[model samples]
Target: MQDNLPIRKIIHVDMDAFYASVEQMDNPELKGKPIAVGGGGARGVVSAASYEARKFGVRSALSGAQARRNCPELIFVKPRFDRYHEISKQIRAIFYDYTDLVEPLSLDEAYLDVTQNKKGNPSASLIAKEIRERIFKEVGLTASAGISINKFVAKVASDYNKPNGQKTVNPEEVLAFLEALDIRKFYGVGKVTTEKMYQLGIFTGKDLKQKSLEYLDTNFGKSGRFYYYIVRGIHTSEVRPKRTRKSLAAERTFNENLSSEIFMLEKLEHIAQEVSRRLTKSKVSGKTITLKIKYSDFTLQTRSKTLPYFISDKSIILETAKDLLFQEKLQNSVRLLGISLSNLNTEKTKKKLEEKKAVSVQLQFEF
Candidate 1:
């Protein structure tokens, strides 16, 4: 996809608290209160929780009981997948009004390559905002947008202003914005890498850029090139709307059956560093961080942490994995451990004005 001279104009549309917001929009009385979708049974999981629920630590994937514990006044609702999908289809159809390079990630999100938009509008951000407005007026939903020169920055920028808020990442300011960013916030750094970066004096974009390619290559091998590229805002990665992820993780299975906290931590840290490096080299980030452990009896325990944000940093990845590890009950001597990353990154678009199409990150995530 990168071989051509096609500098594609792409947009990523993400529904805000999609399921919860849908419930709230459908029932005005549910607005402004803690709401969670999906609480039918023991196996029932929270599909989406409102901002109010978020304040109480209620979140998607949490058991119904856990969510109630987090927020006593939380209101639970069932998922309307069919309805949500219908809304998604309606939103995607709107994309067709602009371009055919539309790729749907799910019922709540999609990436549209509007480089040669059908409307010939010349402004992806304009298209993004218009789409949001259309979704609200037609489908009765709210969305957030992020527009930028590339899919990576655009998708990241979308989250900056969410729940109907819009933000733009201008080409001239992309560098400074990235420079001031925390190392952990980078698309591929992961949790372990973030901590290591802290230990190695790499806290921000400037620190990451300061590290010579030789140093990064020596330490991180293939990802060294990517590190340099992103720091300079020189990414050449293409946005293929139809791409799916492969090999989501790279971790180690401990060689010995031991449980020394410090030692185990060191081992996980090393694994996270390797994984982060690999992710950057591959130009990917996983929203799910999985932890695998096997006991001396050959019994296995696995845990996963799904992030609201797509990340590729080792430190964040490791931290989440570590938390998952602690969440589980260990019954025997630790003999093995593994880590994997999933829910990879994809293209996203934003709402932008026609004149600001050159480079703009949609800051629209307000509800």
Candidate 2:
């Protein structure tokens, strides 16, 4: 099977500081300045940071307070998802013109399979160039592209020359490139995993390739096999055109912690309602309801239960979340509450149920 595998032309495109860039593009006053797109409160987190802010060691998911400490001049702007979604659609349209096999990881990045493209472009690198140019010309934002034989290498290469650049790694250079890559830079290798890999004497791809599959499996479980193949530039995962939504969730943090159970329950009710609203809007329902609690001390706990039937109603979600919440004793003052629904009903299943209900209603009218 390995010998029969055909080389594919894959490109990964990533928008540079997408939200911040969009904000700057619309608001001329924000140009050439450090800005963060998110709430700038004590408990708020940065969603995206301008390149200028990044130089100050600011980054997405970093605490707003810390981002402020890094760059005092940093401007904070609220995220406009509607505008971002519109931009994303424009970018995706460009991708579809090149290849229908476009897999969006998020609003800011996507992978494209241009092995057999709509434009009949032989060179994936050229396709990537055109896409980037079109994005800038049409969308008024710059994107970086990485072209390679596979998605993993392409994703890593795209980051090599960022903001407004592109990189292509030929098949012959794949091994050499992977060998020099820092394990920390490998996709899916988070900070915790990187630290674990370092402790196990795997700091770079070279070090990772030195280990046996058995050794890796023993150390890292199933993901060990993934690392084993990826280091050899042997990733076989295709660029899936459709990625399923596995869950829906909503959460909120309070300005002040609440020690009373009644206060916590009230907050949980609100979170549940939000989650249900999202689920309804998405036309999804789930059997599993999870309750997440974050204490004032920053400790977190989650409790979940799976119901026999799928439900997206707010009352049911609220009740289930309340049950999950009460099942666990409060260890500390609650600072945040969250609810998520999983074990989702597929779109086909939802549609079938809707059709069945329609049929039942028609039968009642005939009587």
Candidate 3:
């Protein structure tokens, strides 16, 4: 049904091994080493792995023990989230310079709806190139970018060439590109779905496009239509930030490491005030409070506690953050601290959905 909808120009930018790359960039010493960030312990999972590590059968979510077995000299560095966040902000600023239609997927990935842009660059490929160059020059890291007429194809194109790579599927080439792709390469198709498609003799975009719409709908429900359209290089949904926040977070880095409990509590009071204000503005109350901490050596960790009911009071936020901070074994002086709230009330979310629907309808009428 959405295939009949208007077309949109989209770009997907995915930073290659973001955490590991940041580590490599900051300390040239780590550049060529098989590097991984997160989970040095036997049971912990890897959050990111460098291209060097990826060559040795290492990847994000692999257990540290297994990764060690694969590459004995794998360098494990604790994440420096504050610095990473700063880089993310810098990169995102570059996106906004071209188009306000930026949708942040995470600290390292985003979708840009550059149907209309500040630079008036008619080709999305050129935009992706400029953005990648800006990220490299400004952030001291490299990223891969993909451009297409729609999100699904653009997401796939971005991964086609990786680590300082960029790929573009122009309007004329959309159908040909999708037709040649393996069904598994589709953004939403996972291993399980690919297996199913294989059993059904669906291997390529042409195979998927040949399936009757009714049959697809009966088999895959709402997602069937989505699959049917994307296989033919069609996705009408515009690039958008998922504004629904189950969590809100803000953190601060102090010029000097905190050594005194009294001073820590005073700083938390200010953070709590800011977090509470954000919660109030969103009209959302959270049942969970998360405290993020970074030590002097750049080691980072998080502590979270959930309340029985949602809360948005400054005093409650301050008390919870303080409690979590004190509970931690403070072996090192804290250099940065942050408080976040999550698991918001559903009633407010329902209202937001209703408002979003009205806005969508209004936009349709205006168009």
Candidate 4:
């Protein structure tokens, strides 16, 4: 561990099968059955699956048709975003009682810095335990937690004993715990990166630790440095309370594929209106507008334009999408149409950028 880096207590809390659990909780009939929360039609995708369904190899992002094939008895429940948001607020309220340093990753999980909590509890492990108990009692939901010196380990440890369990990696044991972990289990290392690591004979944290910083950078570019330090228990990223919104988008999948641009103009107008409304609600505008098209053959394409000035008006957005739509002929019938706005006005503050720079410099020391 680097002497200049701060040693703090961090806990990552994740809800177990959140959407599926909520469906089962609200309707007792689904409690012990295999259920999926999403449409079960041909083009439908499973947003979440109950644990019972998971035993049959059913999981999120699996197509509805494949999910049904995996578990014939699976019941499909439509997602209730409003209800989930309500429950999420209740869970966050519980977190505020313990600490103000809460960084929510999604509706299901968050990271909390409890070094100096409202309860004056010095033990992060104990605080995590209390938080989990409170969630079960007040919200009637099960949550798992991991306590460690930094966010990276805490995020990974939270998954060690899942569903309804917790793990604490003390400062002294952090090194051994990470070294034994599978490379695939590390956060931010996705499937493609895992395959690349395998090609380089990096299968475990111990194997990764054997490589030099220069060697990692040569192979993995900027991420190589991250792999070098993270394997040594030196992640210094603080738990940020307010994460910025990088982009906003809205899209729709049609019931029937449209063959001509004339058929898509109406759809683009509606999509542009939705995106405009969202931008207004967030009190932000964007200089970049993107139109995403998905063909019936499953191929996808995007066209974007960056204006000199920011815009949030529906008319301007619709005009921009129309121009992109006519930029090229239709290669195939369209199955999905989407409009997204980026280069948002709410960019990161100078303080955040400086903090990131400082973190980069701090991690440059030899292990």
TM-score of each: 0.62, 0.92, 0.71, 0.92
- Which runs of model 2 end up more than 4 angstroms from their true locations? 348-367
Clashes of each: 54, 0, 0, 0
As a whole number from 0 to 100, the lDDT of residue 235 in candidate 3 is: 76
Clashing pairs in 3: none
Tally clashing residue pairs in candidate 3: 0
* After superposition, candidate 1 runs with Cα above 4 Å error: 1-7, 40-44, 218-224, 244-367
Question: lDDT scores for all predictions?
Answer: 0.77, 0.91, 0.87, 0.94
Q: Flag the better candidate by lDDT, 1 or 2.
A: 2
Over 136-158, each residue of candidate 1 has an lDDT whose tens digit, in order, gives 89888789987776766677778
Residue-level lDDT tens digits of model 3 in 181-257: 99989889889888988988899988998998887888778988888877766676778755556788777767578
Candidate 3: 10-residue stretch with minimal lDDT: 1-10
Candidate with more favorable, higher TM-score: 2 or 4:
2
Give candidate 3 misplaced runs (Cα > 4 Å).
Answer: 1-5, 247-284, 287-309, 312-367
Worst 10 residues of 1 by lDDT: 346-355
Ranking by TM-score: 2, 4, 3, 1
